[model samples]
Target: MKNFIIICFLLLVGHQTVNAQKALRVYVVRHAEKLTGDPKEKDPELSPEGSERAQALAKELKGQKIDSIFSTNYKRTKLTGFPLADKIGISIKTYNPDQTKALATQLIENAKGKNILIVGHSNTVLEIIEAFGGEKPVKPLTDDDYDYLFTVTVKGKKVEVKTSRYGASHHTEGGEAKAMKSNK
Candidate 1:
């Protein structure tokens, strides 16, 4: 009876440990290319190319079981995430772009073992990645860099970051996009 009790306790503890290690996958991306040459336009809707990119994003993530979608409250950001949200039958939840830490904390606390999508801007994408304890790109994303997709996996406090691209090539050379990975 004593041996059986110990074995049962060990099994229970092991099961809990496995549950705790379930990975939470987060897909983060900057809003697709926006209209340029407009100084007076404070918030512009996505351009034609941007619209296509948004659709591409939706196609890329479709059938991935995305539990939730979050986007900054901006015309571009919301539009970027809208296609995926509609395809997945989930509404896009707006979040303040400036509140990076708060968003990260909320995601880490409540979004464990779930898939999340975040649509942000060029300036904020790196900040969001770091806030989630994931690796940021070596070079800050420039205004013209719109095809990058950042996949961040969180298992407890451990983070793994993988960078890839989707849609049309934004690079000058027009070569195939490359991918990078980092673990923390």
Candidate 2:
């Protein structure tokens, strides 16, 4: 009877241990292109090309089971996430761009065992990825950078990061953006 009790105890402990390790998947990206030409504009909406790119992002991740979507409280970031949020039937939650560490903590604590997407600025995307214990890409994000997609996965204490691209290529030949034909 003692042997049976010991075996049962071990099984219960193992089960609890397995349950404690939460596996989380997060997709992070800088907001798509914003309207340019105004250095004083603190919160500009996305350009028309950026809008199309946002729609492409939605199409890219629509099949994935995204539980929550987060964005900075800016027109660009919000617009970047709106397409996906609308497709997933979830609302976009705003987080402080200056408080990446806090947001990372919140994600780890509350977003365990789920899938998440975060839209941020070029400066903040890497910071948020690092805060989540994931590796940043080799190339630093710049104002002109807009096509990198980062996937951060956390299982137990293990963190893995992968980088890829989505939507229109921001880096094209001759440093010229593909001319977006205006609807007007």
Whole-model Cα lDDT of every candidate shown, in order: 0.86, 0.87
Error of 2 at 141 (Å): 0.7
lDDT by residue for model 1 (1-184), tens: 9999999999999977886788888899999878876979988889999999999999999977999998988899999999999988889999988787898888887777899999999888989889999877548877677888899998998999998888877564443333433565
Q: lDDT by residue for model 2 over 53-107, one digit each (tens)?
A: 8998998899879999999899999999999999888999999878889888887
Q: How close to the true structure is residue 9 of candidate 2, measured as C-alpha lDDT?
A: 100
Q: For every candidate structure, what is the RMSD over all alpha carbons to the true structure, in angstroms?
A: 7.3, 3.8
Stretches of candidate 1 off by over 4 Å are 1-18, 172-184
Q: Model 1 shows how many backbone clashes?
A: 0
For model 2, the stretches where C-alpha displacement exceeds 4 angstroms are 1-16, 172-184
The CA lDDT at 76 in model 2 is: 95
Clashing pairs in 1: none
